[model samples]
Target: MIDLNNIEEVIKEEKKILRNKSKNYKENFFEIKNFIEKEILHIETLKKNGINIIPEINFKDLSPSLIEFKKEVKNRGCVVIRDVFDDNLIHQMNKDLESYIDENNYYEDQKKKSDIDKYFSDLKSGKPQIFGLYWSKTQVNIRQSNELNHVKKWLNKLWVNKHNNQTIFDPNNELVYADRVRRREPGDTTLGLSPHCDAGSVERWIDKGYQSVYENIFADNFIEYNPFNASYRNETQEIESAAVSHVFRTFQGWVALTEQGPGDGTLQLIPIAKSMAFILTRALMDDVDDNDLCGSKPARALSVNSTYHSLLLRGLVSIPKMNPGDTVWWHPDVVHAVEDQHLGKGYSNVVYVGSTPYCDKNLAYAKKQSKKFLEGKSPPDFAAEDYEVNYKNRAEISDLTPLGKKQLTL
Candidate 1:
């Protein structure tokens, strides 16, 4: 947490760096300020809505209301809600998956999909256990159950359209990616999520689109810069990939699957959203040169291959940990990387959720994705060789009912 006091120094250096690189510094610097302001507003809204990563959020056995959960996701731009679904049910699902694997040795997908090292490991040693939640009748039943559906409905409301606020499955629409969950173990540190913005670029001199949802910085003079403008996110399930398509991933989220406390394999965050974005963007730019347009970290003064390399010499970005049943959500543009769960007993399990997005430009991209799926190939938004999975279906939950929104909605 960079102290509000150090912000002045940061801004001073920001200007120096901006001037040193100095391209449209004036227009962009203030926009940087605007971005910070908007993020604060968004974080505040997240707090009021219930889940917060701020120092004040006390996740002590309390569960937030569904409406409040929806609001929290809208305001904070991300959250971790405790017991969004019954923990016991998740426990049962885990047991059933393990049993299914044991009974039939249901490892064909793993075998067929896996390769040399992985196959040798699986056949000789073993592969990581994968429960068929993607296909299991039990997993399907639970994910679609009324209680979970209520959560999904609110997700649809918070993520899609607040005006429609429709908490039921409109056959025409469904919650996106209603089937994404992962049970992270205590010592697993290789899940590989780099701290990068989803929308691709963060050129300050570009469009109105944000690199970080800094409401405090962006919404100057708006008595309130409304964070939950549902119109920007009105869609249900669709899309082949959330990456590359660049739909509004306003909030990145997760639902807790167990009791997580401090030092218990919790989720961590860089509390100051815009400041991190500003410094990181500048850090990358300042570290690069005219030739390295690709901007690889070529032996520079400012390179953080280690996630812990502090960006600011004088100030530290604050991070808050979350507990199981405790959800930790954040703005889409906010940079987040999983903390290594080095000191926990069981596992830190979660269902990752991000806001559903729908827009005309995104829709056209999705139809192309459907074509790729039909051809039994990777979706267009991804590289030809990327994310080639044997998973059965990738149909959009809606179109916005178009292709792009539909694919990513999942």
Candidate 2:
């Protein structure tokens, strides 16, 4: 068994194991460097031409067989789907969420606390942008909405779900991976999130399952690294932490409940799908210490910053203006951040909804999450705030639709 307390030793040992497994490691490093340099130049050119990097598709236009649309999504690593939900429903959800929090005295209760959850301790905001409350009726309704489910299945099909003649995940089937809601007030000056990849941090480098997922990159053939392939992802295990998710999400997404644009504390993404290769190979360079994986830590998200990833950072672009009922989705490996300031007049409200297909890992998590949903507690993957357990108007199992029940593995 791995000792969580002695993580430094584990880091050093994993680095050595990877180095030994690699053939012509130095040459491979140089090749990856060259590719990144070229990719940066290409990104710069696109910016010079005033190109909108994040693809936008109307919900009606989405189709599984649209080869060109699929190519664009594959190339950019992120997309914004418009009108995925009804405007009336979305507006009601926003009002319902506010009423739920206000009626339960959530903010008043929070003010008495000395500190926020450790996972979000680094964030700076006048008021909390992310709420710990999970079982709100608005959240449950949104998670089980037909429009969101349809969009999720379409997004999942973009991945190659079979490897070595073995089916790894069922794209047609989705599992509920409950996450939090965000409501950034107008003129909010939150420090906002930094560029990072979720799911796992150092585990991506140290875990055996993750290593297999990126075997081509480790073997000095990063050009063959296909980010869309869902081979060993379901088998990967992250260190147990409040910040780490135990299940694999093909895409991390959010539905915009308010009209949020570039300056409205919206999300920004590094729009290259294959940038994971640059991240993995860059850490193996001689300059970085053997025990370090480029600013990675056990319980934190995988960070991408100017020091270790200036090239990839250059490609960072904010999503275009999104209206209520619109949604944005990005590949799990994509690096994303939030705009530091909310200059817009409206509140930036969104509900986190990830595309978690049916798999052993995801199904197991869904089962646990279902229990939490029933008990009106936080999902197992998050901090145990349990703010909703005693709160009035929390959604119950009877409130769930048939589709929601299935997604929650009920």
Candidate 3:
């Protein structure tokens, strides 16, 4: 439904804007290049010493008093919070999911599978591992859990509104984005999603509202840019599509249902604030052709790696080992990817949950998501598939916790 001609004109205009700012961009490129050279050495040294750069913390220990901890989280753009849910809760939750799958004969049901199977069909077993069925009793319980909701609120607090002291949303209040669960079997590499930032793709430079997030880099004031600043994020809208993000997530996070470690189907993130500035500026260097907005487009996943971002690819590292109760979160703009293979011995499962502060745009999406939940359908931002409609033992309205009811407007 998108007009390709209009997109081409917008791309041309964006190219012109960058061309006009070429002088400053060229000047800044060398500084970024030098910085990257040093950073690569530092990252390599850390990797050699087996020290992971991703910050890790215990949920109960989180406090404003931990200034250094908070700063590292903001600087790295990703964090792992241990013990977000108690050991008992996580174990029970995992069992619940397993039982649900078995009870529903999920493994035998072709309709319950994800497209990830086709991408890595060679590695996938006869069993369908990654599940698309949302609203499962276990998933609903986890989404509505008090511990999980509290974690979402805390994650939202990391963002500092930097626009004239005008508050548009309350970080204390959060919205629940309906997402899927990834239950990968051992040695499965079906999730081959390469290094890419989520939320906005071409919209990052095309939509005025979304473009504000990176305005500093575009204007050659890269150093002043703060990824944590929640400016114009709520107002930014994405063209309704399966690939476009429906809401702005300050931190895209997940609840681990199984233990995972490096080389064990863990997440990989480019953990540096400066890398973002570098990516934007590098995209505008005079060498870049006018036909491409740094190879970005609506609904297409933007890749950042050795091809377009060499420094970042070298610096990418997996987080420390995670247990069942642990949770990991990363800034929405953080470049992340899944490990290409899972060498582990068991299934690595996780539920997608993120920190979405209550805003006009987010609330509207949540309202629609709530309606979809009741109708046994996918959320607005997702494809309107009716995969879970007739499933047995699915979560119902009564299963919602007090906080969940408030978030879903039940």
Q: Specify the highest-lDDT model's number.
A: 2
TM-score of each candidate structure, all chains considered together:
0.53, 0.96, 0.91
Q: What is the lDDT of residue 265 in candidate 2?
A: 89
Please report the candidate that would top TM-score against the real structure. 2
lDDT of prediction 1: 0.40
Clashes of 2: 0
The residue-level lDDT of candidate 3 at 305 comes to: 51
Residue-wise C-alpha lDDT for candidate 2, range 303-357, written one tens digit per residue: 7878889888888888888988999999999999888888999999999889999
lDDT of 1 by residue, 303-397 (tens): 22233323421122223444444455566545454444436677665555444333444444445544554444444533343222344332223
- lDDT, model 2: 0.85
Q: Listing every candidate in turn, what is its Cα RMSD in Å to the true structure after a full C-alpha superposition? A: 10.9, 1.8, 3.2
Per-residue error (Å), model 1, residue 102: 5.7
**Counted clashes in each candidate structure:** 46, 0, 0
- lDDT: which is higher, 1 or 2? 2
Q: Ranking under TM-score, best-scoring first?
A: 2, 3, 1
How far residue 169's Cα lies from its native spot in candidate 2, in Å, is 1.0
Global CA lDDT computed for model 3: 0.75
